[model samples]
Target: MGVEITSPNFKANAREALDDNSLQKALGLTVEKGFIKKRRLAADALPEFEALRDAARDIKNHTLDHLDLYIEAFEKKVVENGGHVHFAEDAAAARQIALDICRKAGARTVTKGKSMITEEVGLNDFLQENGIVPIETDLGEYIIQLRGEHPSHIIAPAIHVNKAQVEAEFRRVHTALPPDRDLREPESLLAEARGILRDRFLAADVGVTGANFCVAETGTTIIVTNEGNGDLTQTLPRVHVVFASIEKIVPTLEDASQILRVLARSATGQDMSVYTTFSTGPKRPEDPDGPEEFHVILLDNGRSALLGTPFQEMLRCIRCGACMNHCPVYQAIGGHAYGWVYPGPIGSVLTPAVIGIEQSMHLPSASTFCGRCEGVCPMRIPLPKLMRLWRDKAHDEKVVPTAQRFGLGLWVLLARRPKLYHLAMSVGMPLLAAFAGSRGRFRSLPFAGGWTRHRDLPAPQGRTFQQQWRARRFGR
Candidate 1:
């Protein structure tokens, strides 16, 4: 949110993190191999994954179409159940609402379950600025918070970070640990974190989480997680706040269940997470332990604006991270490269819309159009197509450079006339060959200095493939 991360310059920060070859090697191994394992696991588990995906997508599309009606229904039900609903048009408003609630309730420390909406609104920073401490309770989030780094992956926030790095982070951040501590095992590291976080969770006056789905028919906020931290975060503190995009609303628990069927299966290869919790409202008077106060912050934040547009399909996202996990660009460059809170295929499209399309012009173009992200998305979102629309929007807004404009223009001209295009290629090839010389690599070339600056570009052979094909067919 504070900084901009485009695909091109994110490389610098990653290179810095990769100053040691080991970190780079670690990231490469995880990004490439881990995804393959997960993909295969999901495929092996579900014989009708494609069918499930289609059903999921249709349900989401239906939900998006009736979002306004569902949201109104959700609001009415929440109020009827004694939970407060606050609508925010933007991040600042959402942050202010959260801050106001904490202040009124005399909150000191707040524990948070991982919520991307909170991250979008900068809730932690806002609270801290006002002298309230907000601790991330999710294990991955806790690690990144300690390191002052952002989440690299949506579901697996610290996916790029290795165990040793986490051990170092723990030693640096954990107060109870001795300076001489050298823990390597994940269990030990987790135990240390648990000790620290457990105390925070118990002492906190407020707890917050993001909703996976909100049922309009029942006014329930559904949270799905493996570690059960979300349940603790929602129930432990006196007050609980749920920050979510309005698009998360579905008509009923049945719809939520359908989405859930795809969420865990696509995410972690599990039929269901260890915990799939749905909190209806504030704790009943007779209930022994649950939040006394419940607040739901519905963030509009350009989301509602996209409802009727082509990008509205994005609202169907379950935040599964399947798109990013399976994304080649995200796998190679990591999340920080996207330069916004959201990353990968979803981020590439969403960030531009949330921020300005101009600032994130390069994000959509980062994709290889592989469509793997789309294929794996439980919601079956057309991620690449949406990204292309973003690119078109960027081009229309003149965010793209004149160089790109001219190049595309020339390409269009060449495509429209086959004969002249062949003639131009025939003449251009030898000149390119001469420039490339015996090495067959171009270091720098006209209008392509940006590309050749980092890596050598392979020279095109003097013979065009089309010409060779024609000659072979005719035996010339």
Candidate 2:
């Protein structure tokens, strides 16, 4: 089945996810073992880390400004190096192009590296429907594939699943293995997956992977992974296909290197991912082992339109996922609640651009505006600012609900008149404080069920800040 878009009902999805015990357990581990501390250590170790972030952002900005020229240069170099570049305007076009390539190659099986672009385009289901098997090589991805679910996290696809869940899935799917086989630990699970995927890798006719960065100067595609699966996925097959979004392009190898310096530190807290592979084209005549055919499917999917607009800064995202990792909202609920390929803060901004704001208004509104995402972002993309821009657009288009608009309208009216605001706040604070009684909190409240449903609302102190300030200044 094609990956579903549930972004329109993100609130409902988030509510349901909040109630799932299994999901909650998995999400808790993410908080305990998050990238924040490690990222801090890595950044502290490199005094030039912040400078590299600025350079990375500048490189992306410069490349985007000259994207057309660089795309031409990239394509020219690809052809010169005996590789083909296919431009896809949207998801459908991308799917059809990939399917056509598979059909031409007469591929029966294809191995895939962890590519969110492929998930975005629903490539696996499309290929399966056309009678081709698409095997996921990434261990996290492979687990999710067995469960027939989309990835919950960008880098950790099966982050919502625990070891027991994986054990159950392996037992259920790998029935050919002995029933009494020991699968108690993660190492055993890893070994089982590796053995299974190794066969798929060698038997596959086509390998599809996502590019972390595509170099314009040399027409090279790069993938950075901790596991060696991506290398195996691309090299073992006869045809290698790279799925990449338009904004993935960098002007030169040096520009890619600048971004690479920060990518791993922000992502997994490592100085570098274990494997960083660069492929310029198909294997040469004398090359020992590489794909015979190399093709890149450059997907637009509404990214081109984001240029020159307020949302253009979103294109600077390197998909390190630090934003999601640091987001309090995402930490509590996890990625599936966002109901799309991309989730967390980046998803909130980029989803609306790709799928339309009218259908994804909830995503932008989902933020707490704590700015942790922007704080942790390697490219310094100002994610919270971009999310606020989406909110403004949603309000301008009048797509926001009537209740929200009315509430905002009331606030705006009161906020415009200082005397009226002060009077209302003075009265409201006293009333709210009295309602809270000696407990100093409310477990439930009328007209604010959403806030009270999960946590208590702290009571106001019965005195407005203005009153306290006046009393302190004049002893009134």
Candidate 3:
């Protein structure tokens, strides 16, 4: 929610939002009601929901393991269909490639479908900075764009902005917009936005969209959305550019369908999204409509390195956003707390993978080790396990502060030998018990100063849990 998208002084911003009754009403309604509906719909639709999840996981893993072969085959198909394919190793290269294509096409106005890759590359701002106007065709994204805000949710970008907020944005941005024109209702707002953007769609020189799945067999870039915006974006303009991560390329349309089964049911509890558009290439002479020039930009952005590793399972994500729906932290703080385009469990893992874990070391630790995210994940992505691996990798890189490192080192020493562990606990317990005087909790922890500042910790009673378990089992 917008409550979580505070740019600076995030704590203060959140504090203010929590205190604001209007904002809290909107935020709480979004989380509680939306999640309940989705969960119920998912349960009622599929009796073998759990098994289907496992099947999707297996299919994704298999596709990822053979990514190179599939991507090569996909590129060949794209070339044969009169579409140009470009590979970008990182965001900078991707931005350059996309900007150059737009420049060659002389694109002044561009309409876009929802794309996390574009957000990752800051493509919208980049294009606007170069004097080209970019319009988000998706309704949610359009609202956020008009408000000069980033997406707060992947599936529902403007979820944070309620009807009242949207009415305000429309009144401010849409000049000469009549207060008497029924801006109060959501349907009225949608009508105004559609009417306003219809001309932009016809006049725009280029259409930009993200590929949900790229079929290697036919070079078709498949896009899925509830509305038909993706089709309009792919067809109404002279040139089309599809920005997709390399991991999105699958062996065939059949593989894409397997993913689709879980994708809709997980994200929005729908059996299928309203529109699933597939575009093979540019318009042929006989074809009445479609882009004249088609370009597919396959972005690696550190995804290739994740292959052959524990984190590779993450690539199996269909972006169904079920993990976000089930995440405790995400529900509390929302997507913007993670500070990237992708958010929730998937973002926490993928952001550090794309950027260095050193820069995003706090992300993995942001969770409470709650397994709900993994349990609800349609792909069964073992999010907590992968996050732990990232935690370990960040530690190996010395990303943690020196003081914390020293404390952990001491803990490791104490944990190695049973004699030292028991001896240290014996010495440490009395001191802790003494500090935990009246409250029965340590409010001012010495080593965990930052942690204790916000919350209290319980003092150890006597011995470790392992000791108690061993004593009960074998009378040790």
Candidate 4:
């Protein structure tokens, strides 16, 4: 239930992950395979994809600007539709509100859809500590839940886990099953998970899900999922609870449509997710099958504070996760190395904002500034720019490591004086180039072991860029 801050230890976590053979193998096979190709194909097929992305970004910007009005309108509509809306100021508040709802419903078991917000709030463990069992119905979530780990990826929670690992967990947990059952293939593993989760769905007293978009005009909480587990999770239980952050609200259903167009494509490379459910309220009297009670817990959790700041543009994120998908760093080390609920470039920028830069400074610095995340982002979020903002904040606050600070300080001192900078570069460049001789790359460097240990640092060819530029420009 407690929020564990491990962002400060990203270096150590990344190092351990790099050496983990199982994780590395899993990441290697999956990271570059599905999402990227599918997303590219999907976008290419859609002639208006770029226009839709622009519209989605503008819609989010406008809604965020008028967030207060939309929130009020949303609350009113939810009330009108026979549902309750609770505002939570922080993670603790959000967890308490959800727990109170479950308790009021006398919930002994809760079925959950794939919700990163629940993970953010540490809700599953909190509910369990309160004597309520929370079952993750999503296959990916189910796998990670059994292992007592958080989601490694946003869309694919168990992407870091291979079939062998899953088979082992299933055999270990589902002892009632035949020991000889074949679970080698993904299909068999999925079938086994489906059979096990079915009973939990029927037995659950409460259903919890996170909303992808909340429609203020219609009082609708929208969820897009490839699996139908979200539908079952929200409908089968007596009470349904929706978890969402403040930025999830859009002005109307039309705005939701604009965002939805890009959400699935940017995420899984599908034109549309299999299930897009909209729940306005609880089951009506004439309704056949749905939850009798509906409640939404809207958590601010420091998001409201970011409204007018330089980071406000981050609110435009639709959680499509294209940024992480295309990120070279994320692809190499995988999501767990980021050490937080969110991972990759989006995580790099947002984690520090929600959690504080002091605790998550390493996340921003983990990037190579490759700009792929920004290029692929559906909402056009300037991920690299935002990360730089975080880095600047870390430097201003003096939260960066002493060694890093000293290095930057030394560079700045030399940089301010052009003659000293040129002298150092002019002298340092050729010596380094000569030291390389035939190889032209350093296998190891004194202060840059971190870079050189894993891969060779390309040696300078000859003169520095400044030296070349002066010779070309003034004929020096």
Error of 3 at 34 (Å): 1.0
Candidate 4 has what TM-score? 0.95
Give per-candidate clash totals.
Answer: 1, 0, 0, 0
Instruction: Please identify model 2 stretches exceeding 4 Å from their true place.
Output: 423-444, 454-476
lDDT of 4 at 410: 97
lDDT of candidate 2 vs native? 0.92
Write down the lDDT of every candidate, Cα atoms only: 0.85, 0.92, 0.82, 0.92
lDDT of each residue in 294-398, candidate 3, tens digit only: 999999989999999888989988887778777766666666656667778898899788766766677786788889888778889999999999899978888
Name the lDDT value of residue 210 in candidate 3.
94
Q: Best candidate, TM-score-wise?
A: 4
Regions more than 4 Å wrong, model 1: 1-23, 179-182, 430-476
- How many backbone overlaps does candidate 3 show? 0
The CA lDDT at 434 in model 3 is: 69
Between prediction 2 and prediction 3, the one with superior lDDT is 2
Give per-residue CA lDDT, model 2, range 1-476, as digits (tens): 44688988888888888888888887777653667777888999999999998999999999988889999999999989999999999999999999999999999999999999999999999999999999999999999999999999898889899899999999999878788999999999999999888899999999999999999999999999988999999999999999999999999999998999999999988999999999989999999999999999999999999898878899999999899888888887888989888999999999999888998899999888999889889998998899999999999999999998999899999999999999899889999999999999999999889899989999998899998898899997
Ten-residue stretch with the least lDDT total in model 4: 25-34
* Candidate 1 C-alpha lDDT tens digits along 1-476: 33334444555644554464554565578656765576668767788877788888888799889888889999999999899999999999999999999999899999999999988888888788889999999999999888887787888888767898898888777766987765788888888888888888899999999999999999999999888889899999999999999989988888888788888888877788899999999999898889988899999999988988999998888898888878876766677767778888999888877887877777888789999998888888899999999988887888888877898899999999999999888778877887788898887877788788888789988778777788799874
Q: Candidate 4 residues 385-408, lDDT tens each?
A: 999999999999999889988998
